[model samples]
Target chain A: MAQIEIRDLGIDYRKPKSNEVFSAVDSVDLSVEKGEFVTIVGSSGCGKSTLLMAVAGLVDLTRGSIEIDGKRVDGPGPDRAVVFQEASLLPWRSVRGNVKFGLEMQRWSGGDLNERAMQMIRLVGLGRFSDYHPHQLSGGMRQRVNIARALAVDPEVLLMDEPFGALDAQTREIMGTELLRIWERAKKTALFVTHDIDEAIFLADKIVVMGRNPGHIKEVIKVDLPRPRNESILDSDAFHELRKRLRAHLAEDMSSMQLVQEVA
Target chain B: MIAEFFYRRQALVLGTLSMIGIVVFWQIAVDTGFINPFFISTPSQVAAEFKVQFEDGSVATNVAATLYCFVWSLGLAALVGTILGMLAGWFADVESALEPFIWFKYSAPTVAFYPLFVAGLGYGTPTIIAIAFLFALTPIYANTLSGIKNTDRDLARAARSFGARPLDIFLRVALPGSVPVMMAGLRLGVGRALTGVVVAELFGANAGLGYAITYYGQLMQTTKMMVSIVIVIALGVLLTQILSFLETRTDSWRVDSGR
Candidate 1:
């Protein structure tokens, strides 16, 4: 059984004055098995992030339904956690405090709560900075805290929207590896959305390539490359071949969109 | 340790020196007859009046009165204003309804309402407190409202996604996030509260610093009047320093918390 399932999902934004409905995501069907890693890659306006939001129950579906653990999603629940592009750490909280925020909201208590939060902080390599505030840490460190906060809740599914999009190339790569290491340990189903094809390939068991013009799925590609993935894998022939194939699909999707526009 | 101490106390030393310089200049002006002592009072004369007031217990009574009024009024203003402001800030319809009145209260001369307060409350500490509460409430409301509005939506959304209820998000995310601006509003309100106290007492008050200043000034007791005026100024400076100390603590939290 799928951990998360989206069938014919659609989201529309209606202008308040004109009442003209614009489709952001239309007729998208996808599913993630338990412990599977899925990445959605698309250009801007492809509604990839919107799809992730729907799965996280942050967005109301204009049509169809999303089911998680074989139950329909009505609103946000503890079964899933989302990591935003920005770290979004509360300024008044230390790193450990921030990690514990979700747990506190979930009514978790006792000494084990602190112990679990500290374990998550250490998991993200922020053991020393657990007491530090978000501003004192580097951008990468902040994102690490953001990830730890999500993971600490022990949610069955993790939804991430360009979690490392704000980082520099070096930091982004490093975070990607760190995320895999943590994900391997947690073994939770993950649905990640990003515009970076390399990031998608590096982190995903399967990649869903999205396209604009009503934001529909263009293709779903599987990464045949072996893991545990490392920097050396980027130099491998299989990685290059996969990268070329994903790029070609993206380019084709763009031209087809342009063709549709021209025909109209 | 000595160097660190000096660095920490530099502002205190400078402030004291500047105050001494002003007193010396005032004394010179009075001795040379450049300014009449009858109108302005010499530094020594003002100090003597202060000593006399202290000995007779009038200064203590007036100080207690003013502090009493300030504490009650400012405390009420902070409490009521923050609650209403947070509600208005969190809810759209409440904000829209209250916005016009808030702007009117903020822009109008608060002193004009003292006469109305006096008429309603019948000329006592209640009247004075009403004036202070009226004047001080607006800044606290405005700051909290804007602070709630300016809070990072992403943070709130993140909380919501983690299954945080509305109240939890408001208390944990919105309230703490709004503290910096709320403190700023309180600072503004504190100054306004002081003005409110003076306006109320000046109109008709039995025993307060403002009443003392007006009473002595009308009788041409320049030294006595100067003593009251100096005390009022000192109170303002002291209150501001205490608030500034609070602001610095919040500042450290902001810097480290990534706010």
Candidate 2:
């Protein structure tokens, strides 16, 4: 059975005086099986992040409900953990304290929160900076802590919004592989949002392609590729084909957008 | 290091030069008999009177009394105002309810209504201190509320997503964010308190520097009056400068506009 359900999800973004009343995520229906990684790929401003936030109960849905385990999600709960693009670690908190923050919120007692925090910090390979504050670490290390903090809750669903999109090409590749390794160990149902086609192909068990300007799901492609995926997978025929397909689909949209803008 | 020292030295030199010029003209006016010696004494004569006053211990007692009022009033005002300000900032109802009453207290010329405070708190240094306390509280309360309200919402949201509880967010984030603005209010409050103390003493006190100057002037003791006036001016300037220095030191992260 699917862990989440997004049905007839039409979102209208109404700002004060602007005449644009376009639906950001238009009548989108998507679901996640118990332990699957689903990636939503689109151009910038295509409401991919909006869709993920809706599922995490961060973004208010204009006309739909997102359900988790037969229960409707009305607000953000500890059951779903989200990692944002910029790795929003609380500036004053040490990495260790940040991981423990969520657990402490649920009133988890005594030394248990400490042990769990330490365990997760070690898992993310940020044990060295456990005592260090967020401002002390580099961007990549901060995002790792963000991932660790989310996982510390032992959440049923993990929502990642461009978690590695800020990194350089090499660092991005390394973190992506590391993310999968951690996800495999933790084994949580995940919904990831990204603008990169190759990234969506590399990390996802299923990839949902999004179209811009009142964003709607253009295609949902099943990856069907074997995992415990490594660097060599990028050179494989199956990997190349999936990448090419998503890339071609996005490229056509980009050209059409340019043409339309020029005409208008 | 040498350049920084030179810069400070130049600033001292420029300021001292102007003060010396003013004193020189005043002395010349008295020495040349342009102003009667009985009405306007020279700086040298005031220095001589200061030595006599110091030996008699009247100057020491008066200085001590004035300092006492300045400190006592300022301390209570800061303590009370901060508590009220934090309450006002945190709760909307408290802010709206207390705002108009506070505005009336702040806007009123405190000197015009000195009799009320005198009637309530009574005479000597205590009355002076109460005046300073009332004078200093408003700006601190208002600025503290403004500072807390103006804190960056983005930074707050980031902290919220990390699962920090309400109290933790306030203590760790909100308070630190408010430090730069709070320092501004504190500087103004301390200055206003010192001014209030002097005004109170001038109006009603029996044993302060303000009382000594007025008492001496009325008796035509021009040298003694000059000395007392110098001390009063110095006391106000010294207190303001010290508080400002401490303000910059405590919250040095703000951009130094030097205004």
Candidate 3:
């Protein structure tokens, strides 16, 4: 059995001002293996983030179920940690403190909490910034702290929802590279959600493409890239081929999105 | 040499110089007969009266009485406001139930109810404390409510994803996040509660700085009255300064966001 199995999962959200209930995710089925790095790519409102949130047990399912280690997921647990789109560090805490928040919450008795947090901070190359507050760091640095905080919990699975979405292109690429390096070292199952195609192909073992209008997976493309991938892969033929295929899928999604917009 | 010292501590030097200048100017004006000392007493006269009051122990007694009421009022306001505000912020029903009453107390002239308090509790420390408590309660409640309500949703969400229970979220996330705002509320409460204590003393109290002010004013002893006024002003400044110092210390982690 897969490490994390999501079967026919569905989620619905009620309109804030209205009583209307609408589906956000529907009939979604996906499974992640142990230590696999999977990326989900889609346009905004495609429910890709919603799917990730469900797997993280942050959202309630309207239908179907999600299971981890053959146990049905109910609510957020210490078994998985989520890296939010925003590096949601507590403004009142230093980098080390933010990193230790999850461990403190879990009542983790694995070792000294401060030592574990410091180790994760150093792993993310933020050893010099252990005492810095969230606001003192740059956007890239803040996201690195967020990643470190998630990893500090020593979770079996890591969920990232566009962890670098708020960053510039150059910074985003750098973070992506950095993330893969961290993932390699941590060796934990990771589900990263992003809209950047190159990012999807570069870091992912398999890319799950999602479509909106009651969001569902359209396809899952297995990335054939070798290990220890670097920036040079962006200039390679195989990378271009995969990028082209992903682009085609997105183009199709965009046109369909425009049609839905016109209909609305 | 002096310029270097002044530049190193400009604010401190300037503030001290300005205060000394004002007192010297006032004394000079009174001595030169440019201003009437009978209506607004000279700085020296006020200082003399202060020394006399200090020696007689009336200053100490009155100050202690005023401070006693002020402390009780502010302490009760902080405790009750924080508890109620937390409930109001966390539960929609509690907030809606409190909304109208809180707004009413906020906008209404709270001092006008002093007569009612006097009738219920009788004139003295109880009445004085009640008035001051009313004055201080609203700001503390409002600020704590806003602080808890405005706690960053992202932070709470992050905490939740880490398996933090509701109590954990409240204690670790919401309480700490709300500290800066709650401290601001306390600062405002400090001023308002002081005002309330003095106002109550001015009307019905037998002791306190406010009573001293009224007594000296009626006797046409401007220097003595000015002594009490100066003490009140000094108390206000000192309390606010202490709170501002605490605010900065507690909020040390907050820096201007680069993003």
Candidate 2 residue A174 C-alpha distance from true site, Å: 4.0
CA RMSD of each candidate after superposition: 3.3, 5.2, 2.7
Which ten contiguous residues of candidate 1 chain B have the minimum total lDDT? B250-259
- Which residue pairs of candidate 3 clash? none
True contacts kept of each: 0.83, 0.08, 0.90
Chain B TM-score of all predictions, in order?
0.92, 0.89, 0.94
Q: How well is candidate 1 docked (DockQ)?
A: 0.67
Off by over 4 Å in 3: A258-264, B1-35, B257-259
In candidate 1, what fraction of native interface contacts survive?
A: 0.83
Scored by CA lDDT, what does every candidate get?
0.88, 0.81, 0.92
Each model's TM-score?
0.93, 0.76, 0.93
In model 2, the Cα lDDT at residue A135 comes to 67
User: What overall lDDT, based on C-alpha atoms, would model 2 receive against the true structure?
Assistant: 0.81
Best by TM-score: 3
- Interface RMSD, Å, model 2: 4.5
